[model samples]
Target: MKLLKIAFKSAANRKTGLILASVSIALSIMLLLVVDTIRKQGKSSFVNTISQTDLVVGARSGPLNLLMYSVFRIGNATNNVSWKSYQEIAAFPETDWTVPLSLGDSHKGFRVLGTNQDYFKYYRFAGGKNLAFAKGKQFDDLYDAVLGSEVAKKLSYKLGDKITLAHGLTSTKFAEHGDKPFRVSGILERTGTPVDQTVHVSLQAIEAIHVDWLSGSPSPIKISAEKAREMKLNPKTITAFMLGLKNRTATFRMQRKINQYRAEPLLAILPGSTLAILWNTLGNFEKILVAIAFLVLLSGLLGMLTTLLSTLNERRREMAILRTVGAHAWHIIALFLLEAFMVVLGGCILGLIASYVVQLVAQPLLVQLYGIHIDIMFPDAEQWAIIGGALLLGLFFSLLPGLIAYRRSLQDGLVLKV
Candidate 1:
């Protein structure tokens, strides 16, 4: 206790250099915490983008490719699955639920998904969390539409707002279905996933829009929007689907069955495993971020070491004063160790607070810009271990200066040499 008090008082007298060193460490630590947090949270949010579903089924393609197009809305499907095949599979005894997805349309850069009410009831994401509506209810009428969070905000759409979808994935006024505009009936809550960037409508509505089209072009005999709505609509094909089986153990068997399906060539993938393959491609990028953060931390440690060594010459008189008061050689060393410990611990505390604040500010921005949600949280056990290791390492490096001061104090005796 006495040694700590004396060391703290000594540090206070030379507050400028010590404070600067501590701030350097704090900034470095802050960066490390932020980067590590983003890395972890970003990966978690990415992995849990879709959950609970046992398999993702699509037209035959690479597992990674299917996972990307089916879940992340990236790329295009080589072929679409027949509605007959979908119905037959959905009626399988092992299948618990399924959600059909028809893509290849867009509205103002956001993908348009044609689906059924089964989507909202059976689809899950972020660890089985259900899709929720922020305003209004699900689509009921033939021309009713549902908007995702980002779509509603970006295009300033509201319930009852009219939205026309482009024929292809590219948003263009030329290929837009202006003849059959959809009315926004519901806006889904913000999910911080790809769902936020999608526009959803019933598969029937999708069929109605292209009823009079022949090979992706308007037919010479055009059907008015009213007449199309009155006609029964049935989608011929869908891009992909998600499946949840009653028994998880049946996943592999079902995947194999789908792969060898006779009605049509199909592919089924485990969402978890396929997502792992997708993120593995980003493993090197994650390592690069961590490496950069550690480099900054190394510089901060060097700053602390330099600051402590530079102050040794000035602290010599102080060390001599302690010796005159019966302080032993090791006590002088202990003093520096205690001072270093104080600086390191204090810096870590400040860094944690700064990191928390930064996360609070960054949460909305990440959601808006990248559709990733980051939660603010205290350092976990691993992070605590990291901080404790930093404290011990700083104290270890402070020993050289402590030994130099100890040796000089004993050699010079009680004589003061400026």
Candidate 2:
């Protein structure tokens, strides 16, 4: 306790340099925590975007491509699975539930999902959590729509408010279904996933609006919303579908069956496996981020070391004074070590505070702009391990200055000026 006090007092005498060193450490730690937390949570949230659904089935494509278009809504599907093929697979005795998805529409930049009541009933996310309504009920009419939490919040939509959807995934006024505007029937609760950015409408609405749209161009004849609802609106094909099987053991068998169906070429992928492929594909990027974080930390430690080494020359007299008071060389060493400990400990604490502050300040903006949800986290074992490692590194780096101070005898401190 005495040694720590002496060290702290010594640090106080050089408040500006020590404080600057600590701030560098703090910023480095903050950067590290920010990157690591985002990386871990981003991957976790990505992997768990939808859960309990055994397979994502789509037209034949690479697993990553299928996963991207089907789940993440990233790219256009290579081809769509015929609705007949979807029904055939959905009828499998091993199939527990299925939700067909028709993509390629958008409302104000958010993807439009053409699905049935099965989506609201059977779709799951974040480990089987059911999709719940935040404001209203599911789509009940051909022209009814359901907004994701983000869409409703961003667009300020309410139940019964009419909204129009565009033909393509990008927003352009020329391609909007102006004549077939749909009423907002419900708004879904946030899922912290891609679902939050989707606009939900009945599969028939997709067929109805596009009836006059041939090859992405509007036909000369215009069908009003009322007139279109009267026509048969069964979809000929869909972008993809998600499936849950009756038993986990049937997954591979059913996947193979889907892939080998005679009528059409298809692809079936385990959501978890495909997501793993996606994550692994970006493994190099992750490594680069981690390397950047450590390099920042190393530079901070180096800065602190530089400060301590510079101070040693001027503190020679102070070391001699301690020696005159009967303090041993080890005590002299312990003082600098304690200074390192205090600086690093303070920096880590401040860094954690800064991390939470960043999460609080930037989480909503990130979700809004990019659909990235960064969970605010309390330090777990991994974080504590990082803190411990930083402390060890700080102490180890401090040893050089400690040894330099130790080597200076009483004679050196009392030596006459040149």
Candidate 3:
């Protein structure tokens, strides 16, 4: 207890030097924990982006490409499946419900998704959670649109606001559907999925806007939005579709039939398998993060070591004073060791507090900007292991200075009259 008191006083007396080392260690620990938390939570959110769907069907293409464009709003479809094919597939006995997706349009930079009532009713995310509107109702009219939470917030859109879409997936002035603006009838609650970054419109609305489009360009004679709505607006094709199975046992069988469909070359992928592939592809990145974290931790420990070693020379007089007061060399060693342990303990506590505070502050921004929902909770076993390792590392690095203090005390003892 006396040695602990001495150590505490010594650390307090050299607070400036010790504080810098503590801060470094704390920041490093915080970074490591934050990276680990984000990686695990973000991957979980991505995998759960779409769930309860048995199969994702798209025109002949690589499975990853199909998954990317259909589910993630990335890339473009190689070809569109005919509406006839969609009808036939959806009519299969094994299918429960199907949500067709029509792509190839954009509002600002957000993808415009042309789907139907089934999309809202059948599409599930984050473990079978259904879509809920934040305000107003789903699109009931051909020209009505539903905005995702992010879209509404980022672009300052509200119910009854008018918005137009470009013909392609990006902004192009020449292919603007300026004459056929849609009214925002609904705003969906944030789902932390790709759904939040999309603009939802009905399939008929997609057909209506393209009535005067020919080969990706506006026709010489364009139909007004009013007239286009009055005309037959059935979509002839769609980019992709998702199907929920009537029986879980028949999932693979239905997948096989869809893959062998004679109507056209199509690919069917199980959402779970596709997500697994995505995670496998991203495994290396996670390893990279772990490596970077360890490097930072090493740097922090080295900083603490440098601080202790540098301060040892100045502490020689203090050590000699202790020897004259009947302190043993082992006492000097124990004091330095105790001080290092306390510094590490203090840093660990600060790191934990800072991590929670940062996550709390950044949670909303993460959901809004990147559609990642992080769950802040007590550290898991792995996290505890990491913390333990850090403490051990700090202790190990600190022993060198403790040994140096021990040697200095012995050398100064002979000169002391006492």
Candidate 4:
């Protein structure tokens, strides 16, 4: 009881220094928690986005490239599969369903995806939920379009708003597809995937818009809208297609068949396996971020040490007075340890609160711009382990100054010395 009182009084005397140390520790803890939470949620968002998909088929490319192009909308496809290939694969007995994807166009920097109605039916996200409409209904006509949640919200598009597509994925005005305009028919509910940033349209609509254009660049001679409508504009090529196998056992068989197709070079990949490979390739970046967090934590501990050592000299007379009152050297050590423990504990609490506050503020922006859902909740088991480890580290560093005080008390025994 006496020791506790002594420790409290000693800490009160150095409240300013203690507050500074606590603030430093609190900031470090905030950074560590925020980074860890982002790392965890980032991984969860990626893996959860495509948990139900069986296989992704595309032109001969790396598994990462297929995952990135299809899932992330990050890059362009190296080659496209013909519409015949999609029909053949969809007709296979082992195939349960197929969603054809046509790329190579954008509307105001957002990727425009040309897919059939099966896309909405077969597409699953974040726990296998089918796509739902937040407003209006799906497109019924060739010129009608559906917007992703992000696209609609960012552009403030309504059900009847007409939008023109830019020629390329970039914001430049060089190749605008201005002749054909699309009316927004629906807005999809938020799904926290590339779908949220996409503009969905029918495959026939894609063909209709680019009928006069050859390859990616616009043709020298412009084809009028009326002329394009008269001509047949069926799409012959598609960026890729997603496959759902009827029989899970035949996945390998179908993959082998697709890879060895006689008509064209193609590749079939299990979405899970490709996603794992992609994460492995990019996982090192998260490790680097964690390492940096640890270093920042260490710097915070060092600052605590500096603050204790600086105050040690000023407390010498007070220590002598306590020694005269028969307080042992070990009690003096305990006082310093208790003070540090209190500061670190307080800092950790503050840090956790700060982390939640930050997540709350950033959630909307993250979902809108990056398609990441930041879950603001209590720390998981791994985070608790990190917190435990940090507490021990704080105690260990705090003992350094305590040990110095103990040795000084022993050498200046029973004497009021500087």
For candidate 3, give the lDDT of residue 190. Answer: 86
Shift of residue 325 alpha carbon in model 4, Å:
3.5
lDDT of 4 by residue, 1-418 (tens): 7887877888888888778878777777887888888877877887877756788899998888887788777788999999898899889899998899988889887899999898888899877889999998888987889999989988999999999887667756667778888899999998878788899999888887777677777788887766766777677999999899888888899999999988899988998887777777768987887788788778877877888889887777677777778888778788887877887888788888888888888877767565677778789998788777778888888888988887776566555554
What are the Cα lDDT values of the candidates? 0.87, 0.88, 0.87, 0.83
Better of 1 and 4 by TM-score: 4
Alpha-carbon shift of residue 23 in model 4 (angstroms)? 4.5
Deviation from native of the Cα of residue 160 in model 1, angstroms? 2.6
Kindly provide the TM-score of model 2 when superposed on the true structure, using C-alpha atoms.
0.90
Q: Candidate 3's residue-wise lDDT over 244-336, tens digit each?
A: 988989999998999999989999999889988987887788888878878877887888888889987778778888887898767877787
Q: Please give the range of 10 consecutive residues that has the lowest summed lDDT in model 4.
A: 409-418
lDDT by residue (63-120, candidate 1, tens digit) is: 9888877888878899999999999999998999999999988888788899999999
Q: List the residue pairs that clash in candidate 2.
A: none
Model 3 steric clash pairs: none
Candidate 2, residues 178-238: lDDT per residue as tens digits? 8888999999998898888889998998999999988889999888878887899899999
Ranking by TM-score: 2, 4, 3, 1
Question: Each model's TM-score, in the order given?
Answer: 0.80, 0.90, 0.88, 0.89
Tell me the deviation in Å of residue 341 in model 3.
3.7
Clashes of each: 0, 0, 0, 0
Stronger candidate by TM-score (3 vs 4): 4
Q: Once model 1 is optimally superposed onto the true structure by TM-score, how far is the C-alpha of residue 251 displaced, in angstroms?
A: 2.9
Model 1 regions more than 4 Å off: 1-20, 43-47, 91-96, 149-157, 166-179, 189-193, 209-224, 230-233, 246-249, 262-264, 279-288, 314-318, 325-331, 365-371, 413-418
- Among all windows of ten consecutive residues in candidate 3, which has the lowest summed lDDT? 409-418
